[model samples]
Target: MSASVPTVGSWHRLDRAGLQAVIDVLWLVGHRVVGPQVADGAIVIRDLRGVAELPTGWLDDQDGGSYRLRHDPVAGTFDHVVGPHSLKNFLFPARETIASFVQLNGSWSQTPPPAQVPPLAVLGVRGCDLAALAIQDRVFLGSGYVDEPYKSRREKLFLVAVNCRRAAATCFCHSMGSGPAAGPGFDLALTEIEGGFACEVGSERGAAVLAEAVAAGASIGGCSPEEVEAARGVPQALAARMHARQQGDGEPRPRSLDTHGIRDLLMTNLEHPRWDEVAARCLSCTNCTLVCPTCFCSSVQEVADLSGDHVDRERQWASCFSLDHARMHGHSVRSSTAARYRQWLTHKFAGWIDQFDTSGCTGCGRCITWCPVGIDVTEEIAAIRASGSGAAPPDGAAPAGAPEAGETAS
Candidate 1:
């Protein structure tokens, strides 16, 4: 596949087959293409061999603590919004072996694991997740101490972002200023319409991939002006439909959070009683952090062979909800569920700003949709604000006898 120089800012139209052609070109260039697919009764990001693997014509119904996959053959393949998984799962694996050890003659030696980084091309990356990726990049790359594994994988990643046509019931990216439209950091972006994809290139790699697709006859040509106009209008139309859905009775909904002030709001309300109220409902199952695309807390575990001759040290995802997470000098600082939940919320919305110069949340709403108890962060913040309790309490001021927060009820 070949083509002349592509116009940098132009939008091109690639039909369904043209989209598949791009995937094929990616495979030819040694990229392990991954995208959204129907699996385990939900749309999930996974390794895809071809375009047929996409969850085409499937729509997802997501709300607090609930999700249902419905078939809508009439709808485009990219119609649904995000799912349980995020780009982090692939970039920063949940559990990974960092080192291995061998024991001989009562002496042990450690060696770093072999690098297994592979080229990856991710399709259908949502805007919020892209923002989260940038946050993760800051944590693992921008920070003075770099995560080598993350850097290796990140260097090889090729991102193809997609703008959302419709907002999920739990979505609040608009409030967070993270997305609805693809933002910076992607290689290529796509907006799906009735006949084909309206594509934009964000990098040289994206241009190369798109040129290959065009050369292979995957795209007819540059998008027509009318098609470009239509593509630009899809998001607005979807936003209106979402508004109607959210305001079924034509009643006004609560105003969105003033995210600009969220840092101060959370920092000042450290001892708000609303924390207790939310703690009552929060399972502390760590679903929020797990589903979160930017939560990077982890713990190291050591494993030994049955013969005790070999050992491996692995890094696994950890959650603040766990009692051991706050253990210090034989005492848990956040002994109460309220305190643990407070730590998570504060760290995400407040402390992160001080630490990373950015908010931890991208407002994808995965936490609300996947929580077993349906604990909504936006609602919790609203409740705290409504209480009008912004004064910070003295140290160690959490209420007594509060239940411990974990995956299960105490």
Candidate 2:
């Protein structure tokens, strides 16, 4: 058992026993282990009893408007891509109560919830999702907001990031300049090699796990230099194949729209023709921002028992696509679909950088794939740019596009 930090030298190969041994040790340390397992016709995160419970041979297929589960057949011998759910659920959960207030005998008092049990190990997180977590760290932790729940969950997390051996059609982390390999931010990274798993320790917790598992001989053994290169080459090869098939050429760089002018553009385009086009297809489902790791918007709800003896205030996820999200004094600022859509798009690609000094979009493409109506964000941006340049909407087309949305444009 060897321990090293984020660099490549810290890598070791772990056989099945070694992997299981590490899981056992982490569990002993009071860490709740979570990973993808096959359930309900899809791969979802759940508690793992051992390596066997983790999804083996399970893979997912995603596109602009589709998702499906497929069997890899290779089973344990694969590095699966990140599933629809990322580590955010564990950290910034879908909803949580901060505290509750109660009135008793004409006196008001507050009851605070107990601290959360830190989820110890999150196994099989992909590199892109790892990057997304990093981005969220900047949003929730680094920001002055200091989301208390997110901070608590992050402090206890033991990340096990995996490189992408394959990418779904909708995946574009490579284009967004985020993935193909585990960069920084994970406690450990695993790459599926020929016979076992190539593991790299990225933190002290990861090193301790490696140390506990070493007596079991899960570490990689004598391999020709070529074999090591071959094992490491898998992710890069997979990335290249994905790039070849994607619609656009090279990386889909974030569109460098005029930042100085964007606020005015968004402010002015409230009633633009594109709004009507997009509204037709946008079910007003908040899937895009919901799946977006950087989207930190949330709403609070309070629950109380009939006795009024106990009450709880819960903060849950919110979406810009929802009418109530922008509501003020019984009216929403972005009341219409066109206004809401434009607000989200401009904020993501344009104003986010101006406000945060970093691009909000990592281009994970979750929005493109999860949308039930198949609204392509990239295509919409292209359409907006076209409309701005005096290219009229396609022969009575809606703001988003034609009534029929295509797979993805080149």
Leading candidate by TM-score: 1
Clashing pairs in 1: none
TM-score, per-candidate, Cα-based:
0.89, 0.83
Relative to the true structure, candidate 1 has a C-alpha RMSD (angstroms) of 6.9
Worst 10 residues of 1 by lDDT: 401-410
For residues 1-410, write the lDDT of model 2, one tens digit per residue. Answer: 23322233467766777678878777877889888887877677788769888777777766666667878687553444555677777777888887888889978799766667756688888766676777677778776778777788888888877877877666766655566666677777778876677776678777776766664444534334565577678788976776666535533332211122333344445567887898888888888887776787889998888987777898999888898998999999988887788778877765664565455665567787688887877677656656664333333332341111111100
Would you list the C-alpha lDDT of every candidate in the order shown? 0.79, 0.68
Provide the RMSD of all predictions against the true structure, rounded to 1 decimal.
6.9, 6.9
Best by lDDT: 1
- lDDT string for model 1 (1-410, tens) is 12334556667777878788989889988999999999999999998878789888999888788889999879787889999999999999999887899999999898767767679999999888988898899899998998988888999899998988977777767666677777788888899977778887788888988888778776446766787788877766765565455446422232233354566668888988888988999988988889899999999999888998988888999999998898899998899999999999989887887777778888788988899998888778777766645522322233332211110000
Candidate 1's C-alpha runs over 4 A off are: 1-7, 236-255, 391-410
